[model samples]
Target: MSIHPYIEQAIELLKAMISIPSFSRQEGDVAAMFEDFLKSTGINYYQRKGNNIWIRSKNFSDQLPVVLLNSHIDTVRPSSNWSKDPFSPYEEDGKIFGLGSNDAGASVVALLTVFRLLEEMQQPFNLIYSATAEEEISGDEGVASILEEIGPIDLGIVGEPTQMQMAVAEKGLMVIDGIVKGVSGHAARKEGVNAIYKALPIIEWFKNYRFPLVSDLLGPVKMTVTGIEAGTQHNVIPDECRFMVDVRVNEHYQNKELFHLISQNVNCELKARSFRLNSSFIPTDHPLVKRGETLGLRKFGSPTTSDQARMPFTTIKIGPGDSARSHTADEFICVQEIIEGVNTYYNLLKDLYIYPV
Candidate 1:
């Protein structure tokens, strides 16, 4: 089958974006490129004090609810094992292969295509296109700036790769640190209480810790120890040891409940065991899901966490490409999937705002 003209336009745009390596905080160049695209299309937009760029639709009116289309411009660092040049976009078979092909770049292109189509049709809706930065580590710096300035909106669509599925819910993320303290002593004496040894109980507790199997669109909560550091050297008993824990939580469990549960299970002899919890976001069964389904898009929940967990709007993770290909050596997105995503998003906007009953 021949490709649609809009899809072709999107393909060219995606290639242009993939050529620029917008890795995390280094999104200045790509953001500028997006700004140029907006200006060329004659869309009204402005850059925030930070690197984020916001594009507003000319159809903004009092009757329509403002819709925000959000996607990050940054991609994770490219691995050395990539068979093709990471920054150089390439098309093989039916897929577009590049560094950010699957993670989020596909969604970025889809948004661009959808907006262009909307502008062409003179669609009636208050739309905002946001290209954010620093989403890999935390979205606080980038997204917070937008929220602080623009305030809240009616709804938000986060363009993360959901394999053409509408992700109505996602698990929250919490980063915790465990510190164990013990007495230091020489290896020859071997009389001091080893902090490393004290950490054993904590490890055991973590191993046996039974996370509640709560059923939701996203599934059960999970906990994992991401990093551990204890001993100083072979000849000394280190007095301090620290480990990091990553937890993906469901809506049923709040941070306070989980923290109290963990503290209760931990023994008191490990000195200080503290945790730092971040804010959580939950997705609602908004009208957007029905709109997406009407456009022939699949509906599902996200297994992994995204920046949507930090936003307070009725957030949904939906976009082109597959999550399995994300953060992999040969990351790629089918060209057709990108095209379908653009049409789907266009239809969603039409149903929700342009042609709403």
Candidate 2:
């Protein structure tokens, strides 16, 4: 089948974005490019704060519900393992290769095209498309920074690499720094209570303990002891052990609740870094999910974190490309994936009905 003009336009825009290095906290160059593109398309009322750019449809109204379609504009720094020039865009076989191409460039442009396609038409809801920065780092200047200015969003679609499958739920991430204190003494004489020894059970608890409830969609909350440090010298018994904990929280519990539960269970002192990215889930019976089901899209719990974690309102994640390819060497998205992504986003939103909050 022949490609639509909007799809062609999105493809060319994505290629231009791939050629620029828009790393987290440093997306000025590419954000400028995106601004120029948006202006060229005759979009009049977009807003830019830091590197985040967003625009509402012409028919925006507070009475109607809003559907937010968001994708990140930033890419992770190119890995050392890259065989091709990460800044140079190239097409091979059926794929377009470069940094950020698959992880989100395809989704960014495709969703923007979908917005353009629908902006002039009447619908039951309002539409907003955002290409934000710092998503790879989950920085404050990303989507989390602009939620208030856009007005209240009834629901959201976070565009990550999910191969066009729907992520009805996504895990939230929390990191905790902990310390285990013990008596210190000479190591050779065995005169001290070793802090590292005391830390073993804590690590085991993280590995073996399971939460009380399991989500049918998201399964169990997961925790891992990722790093540990104890001794400063070879012959000295360290008085304190420091460790890092990585938690993947499900929708069943808030991050603060899990942190409190973990603290009560362990002997060590644990402090959560932050609890901003709470787990996100939208019911399978939601109108958007029901429409997606009719279109034969598969729905599953996403183990990977996305900007969906940052949104406070109801949300689902679905987009082009594969999450496995994100942050890998020589990242690329199939040309066909962009074509299908635009069509899929358009079809999913064009006729779907939503109840306003």
Candidate 3:
């Protein structure tokens, strides 16, 4: 099928973005390019921190409920195995290849197309578009700060590479740093308690532990003891054994709840590194979700985290490309995927009124 003009425009924009290397915390150059595009396209937007960009429709009304569309502009550094130059954009057999192609550049351009289209028409709710920075690192300067400036938003759509499936829920992430304390002495004499021995049960507990509540879509919260370190020398019993646990949390419990539960059960000093990215979920019966279902969009829980994890309001993650293609060697997205993404985003938002008008 021949591509629509809007899709062509989105493709060109994505190519331009991918041509620039916008690694996490270094999106200034790419953001400036987008700002130039916005000005040339006659779209009104504001820059936050020289990287994050926010645009609201001219029809914006505070009286109406607002729906925010967001996608990240920053990407993880390219992997070493790419046969093609990561910063050089290429097209082959209907695919666009580059460093950030599938991860979020597709979503960013597709959403920009949707925003431009929607800006010309009437809408049931106010619309806001954010091309955010620092998502790959979850930096404080990105969406976390933008939300505070935008005030209340009734609904949100976080654009990620979900292959057009609507993600009803996404897993939250937390890292626990723990230390097992013990007396130190010569290992040959066995005169002190070994911290490694003290850590054994705690590590085992993390390995076998399960949260009581399980999500219908996301399943049980997962915990894994990913790292352990102890002992200064072969002949000395170490006084401290340090370990780290990687936790993938579900919506059944808050991060604090899980952290407290684990800490109380273990004899060691276990503390959460941060709980900023909490699990996110949107109900199946929500109007936007029902509309998506009617349009034949499938729903699933994302094991991978996204900007959706940080939104305070309800959000459904849907966009172009495949998640598996993200942050990998020779990342690419089919031209058809970007076209489908624009259509899907427009279909899910065009007619639905989140609140009775």
- The TM-score that candidate 2 achieves is 0.97
List runs of model 3 lying over 4 Å from the truth. Answer: none
Q: Residue 147, candidate 2: how far off, in angstroms?
A: 0.8
Per-residue C-alpha lDDT of model 1 across residues 56-78, encoded as one tens digit per residue? 66666667667778888888998
Q: Looking at candidate 3, what is the lDDT of residue 351?
A: 66
- Ranking, lDDT, top scorer first: 2, 3, 1
Steric collisions counted per model: 0, 0, 0
Could you say which candidate leads in TM-score?
A: 3
Q: How do all models score by TM-score?
A: 0.86, 0.97, 0.98
Candidate 2, residues 200-249, lDDT tens digits: the string is: 99989999999997888889999988999889898888889999989999
- What candidate 1 gets wrong by more than 4 Å, as runs, is 1-5, 119-125, 186-190, 211-213, 233-238, 268-284, 293-297, 353-357
Evaluated against the true structure, the overall lDDT of model 2 is 0.91
Screening candidate 2 with a backbone cut-off below 3 angstroms (N, C-alpha, C), the clashing residue pairs are none
- Predictions in order: lDDT: 0.74, 0.91, 0.89
What is candidate 3's CA lDDT for residue 203? 91
What would the per-residue lDDT of candidate 3 be over residues 29-57, giving only the tens digit for each residue?
99999988888777756556558899888
Q: 2 or 3: which has the higher lDDT?
A: 2
How do these models rank on TM-score, best leading? 3, 2, 1
